[model samples]
Target chain A: MISQFIFIIILGAAVYLFGKNVAKVRRNILLGKDTDRSDNPAERWKLMAKVALGQSKMVKRPTAAVLHLFVYVGFVIINLEVLEIMIDGIFGSHRVFAGPLGGLYGLLIGSFEVLAFLVLASCVIFLVRRNVVKLKRFTGTEMTAWPKSDANYILITEILLMAAFLTMNAADYKLQALHVGHYVTAGSFPVSALIAPLLPAGAGALEAIERGCWWFHIIGILAFLNYLPYSKHFHILLAFPNVYYSNLNAKGKFSNMASVTNEVKAMLDPSFVPETTEVSRFGVKDVTDLTWKNLMEAYTCTECGRCTSVCPANITGKLLSPRKIMMDTRDRLVELGNNIDKHGKDHTDDKSLLDNYITREELWACTTCNACVEACPVNINPLEIITEMRRYVVMEESQAPASLNNMFGNMENNGAPWKYSQADRFNWAEKG
Target chain B: MELNIPTMAQMVAEGKTPEILFWVGCAGSFDERAQKITRDICKILQHVGISYAVLGTEESCTGDPAKRAGNEFLFQMQAMANIELLNAYEVKKIVTGCPHCFNTIANEYPGLGGTYEVIHHTQLIQGLINDGKLKAEGGESFKGRRITFHDPCYLGRGNGVYEAPRAALEVLDTELVEMKRCKTNGLCCGAGGAQMFKEPEKGNKDINDERMVDVIEAKADVIASGCPFCMTMLSDGVKHLNKEQDIKVLDIAEITVRANGL
Candidate 1:
């Protein structure tokens, strides 16, 4: 009765904290401007299935894909055992499914043990890949202390959770073998059986170790659930919705702002009266100017750096790194969200996502080749943000680079991007 | 090599409607390097007995560069002017040798109320080849020559047209070599998104030089492309590598004209 009371209190606290943080994040994302992407539910569902569920794009890099698949699949499948553990914790029961599930429970436990081992191995490899091998993409300028440490912490946490799971099962198996206390003997422990012998024999020692491991595992999972909202691991939840609401238009087609289009149309008309001569900002100057989809994209970044790895500008040693763009947007959103929390809803900041985080050199270096957009496994479009910011720099500030200014002038005057006039458009035909 | 290409106004005056409007893009109209491609396309149209008319002085830029460079106001002004001319002329079907123009007219223009059946010149040539209107047997046949295609980003990935240019080239008796990165995975030749209008930022290397390494690694005798901007960039790359004498870069229209002996 005491153990069950302690379990209920801990579980309640964990659920409350996790729910509060998740709700906070949802509210933060809603701070962005509205963009209605409700069209075409069929295509959105298909994209979610292919990208999130099938993991089709992840397989582009086969080695990382397979390793990640082990952890991902292990995390998913082992969580079933977590569900059982939670129930057992609440009721102060050991192997509650053992009698009812019988052979199926044994099969499930055996598979969980194998998967736990695989998850441990994959986590170790992932750690080595990030720290020891120091892959160029992982160690680039963007992988600063927080992101690097965050990755290491997640891996270490996963390793510990899997280790605690196996240790708990090993002690439980030994206790069942000795027919000690209230421990039952029904489920199998294939991998942990190897561990069972290493543990000291006796009922009291086994029960204490088993309960300690059990508490550690459950507490670790709850802590991980809460940590996700604040870490890049947030992608584990956001990737599904991100891919589902991905931009389905052809990659070449950029979305036009309807307001700007209407303004341009008014200018083009022969007889048009301006209703409001009041100035309208041409493009995004702040987070509120960006669409909700853009903000959601900011939150969904995995920081895998596949985008920066394949970025032509980054590879060619330019200032542009698509991964950095997403990271900056996320950081700015966090800053704004925190500001709102501290100073109430009407809070405003002098620092915007533009000059405070991303710079002109970075934005200008992008060729808009869509390489980064294509390379992103989760459909995070840094290009969209880049283009929007570029529009702000150009239209709002009128601060394009000198060469681009020349091109813009040519287009304005000659109706082309070159110095030549429209009257000369057919000059080559005369030569023919 | 003189080709008599009629203007749309001339055709209209004669009370005749050409099957298609030949949208000679700015590069094809003004750039010396792209002029040869323009003539080749005109020669092919004549060879196949397809009546085509140019807008002549009435033609203007499609504002692709302006839109890309974040000058939407200027782009719209240019686009609206051209749309007015196109709508007045009643140009139903249009074909252009430039991918920038093709992409803008086919995709972007529809949003601004300027919609037409915009097709790339390679697609038009492939259709003519399929219709058996143009013969591939004659002068300067590419028989057994190693030819690799450099996909223009706007044409290939931008518009999802990886096959039409290749299909047009398949008629030649040459070995069609492919770069390591082709089709959807093809790299940019350093000249998209208004980069053509300005100098490249300080970098370890130019994007064209990097793409040139792939082209040279393929070891093809000739490099074929469909977009004029790509032609300019790839030609500059070939010159930079000093392979100008060893390798040749020709537009696909030029290839068709040479193969059909037009």
Candidate 2:
């Protein structure tokens, strides 16, 4: 009864902390302007299934894909065991489902053990890939200090969590062999059974080890849950929604600003005189200027650098890394969120996301090729964000490159992008 | 291959409603090299007996360059003017040799009440071949010649069209090779997003040069492309390598015209 009470108190506290962090991130995303992505429910659901659940894009890199698949599937499916543990902790029950589930419970437990081992192996391999193999995409300028440590931290945490679960199972198996109190002959620990022989061979030693492992594993999971909102690993939760809300329009199609369209319509029509209003900023200048979906994209970035890796601009040694674009947005958003929290709604900041975070050089380097958008396993559109910043630079500040300004002038005066008059448009066909 | 292409105003004066309006884009109109593609498309249209008329001087820029350059205001102004003109003409079933113009007119223009049945010239040629309107038997020069098609981002990944251009290429009796990255995973030719108007930032190598590496690896005698912008970039790439004389960069329409002797 005392243990159950202690379990309830700890679980409640973990839940509270996890909920607070998740809520804060949600509020941060809502700081941006609204944009409708609510249309096309069926297509959105299909995308979620294929991209997130199916891991369709992850398999582009075969070795990493397979390794990631094991870890991913294990992380998701092994949680069923966590569910059982939670119930057991609350109710003070020993192997609660084993009595009714019979051999099926054994089969499930056996599968969980195999997956746990696979997850552990994959985590170690992933650690090696990041720290030892030193993949070019992983060890970039943006991936220094905290970003690098954060990735290693997540992998290490998962490794320890899986280790704890297996250790607890191994000790429990030994306790069951000794017919100790509350130690039922329940889960068939196929993988953990090997460790049973290695454990110290006394009842008191076994009980202490089992309880320590059990408590540590649960607490570790709780810590991971709270850490997600602060880490790029937040993609674990956001990937589904991000993929679902992905832009369903053709990749080449740029979204037209309705305000600009309306203004243009008014200009074209003599009857509808546009109301004279004060100068409003055009395009995205700050976090709040971006659409809600764009903000959500920043939060959904996994920092895996797949988009950066496949980027033609980056591959050709350009300054623009799509991953860096997302990271900058997310970091700026966090700053904005913290500022709003500290200073209230009326407070202003000297810095904006454009020059303060992403530079003009990086913005112009993008080709808008949709490669970054396509390469993202979770369907984040970095091109959209880059384009928005470029729009701000050109439309708001009129700071386009001299060549682009020349083209813009040509477009404004003549009907075409060149200096040729409209009368000369047909001159090509008149040629010999 | 020379043919007299009539204007929309001339077609109206003749009291005829053509089946399609040929949207000869800015590059197709002015660029000396892209003009060849325009002429070849005209020849193919004339040979296939598909009644098509151009807007001629009435046609303006589709504002793709402006939109991509982040000048939304300029793009909107240009788009509205072209839309108003097209609406006045009641034009439907538009076709363009440039994928940039096709992408903008088909996808972007609809939101501004400028929707029309816009199709790329490659798609039109593919349709014509499929409809038995045009025949592309192995010509003397192009028979089993090594031809590699560079997938334009706007056509392939942008619009989810990977097959139509290839199908058009398939009709020609040439060895159709593919680059290392093709279709959905194809690389850009360093021209999209208004990059053509400005010099590229300092980098190890130009994107066109990198793409040229793929073309060279594919060992293609002729690099076939669907977009005129891509044609220009790839042609420059070929010229940079001084392989221009050896490897010809031809539009799919140009290839078809040569293949059919239209």
DockQ score of each predicted structure, in the order shown:
0.67, 0.82
Candidate 2 regions exceeding 4 Å error are: A273-280
List, residue by residue over B195-260, the lDDT tens digit for candidate 2.
988989778999999999899899998998998889889989999999878899989998888887
Give each model a TM-score.
0.96, 0.97
* Model 1 ranges off by over 4 Å: A273-280
lDDT of 1 at B171: 83
Q: Please give, for residues A332-427, the per-residue lDDT of candidate 1 as tens digits.
A: 888888998899999897998888888888888887778788788888899888878888888878998899999888777776678998888888
lDDT of 1 by residue, B1-262 (tens): 5698999999999999999999988889889989889989999988888999998877888888777777777677788788889988888999998998999999888887788999999999889888988768876879878899988878887788889999988988889999987886787888888889888888899888888888878998798999888888889988999999988999999999988787
Going through the candidates in order, what is the number of backbone clashes in each?
0, 0
lDDT of 2 at A134: 94
- The DockQ-based CAPRI class assigned to model 2 is high
- Per-model CA lDDT versus the true structure: 0.87, 0.89
- TM-score for chain A in each prediction: 0.97, 0.96
Clashing pairs in 1: none
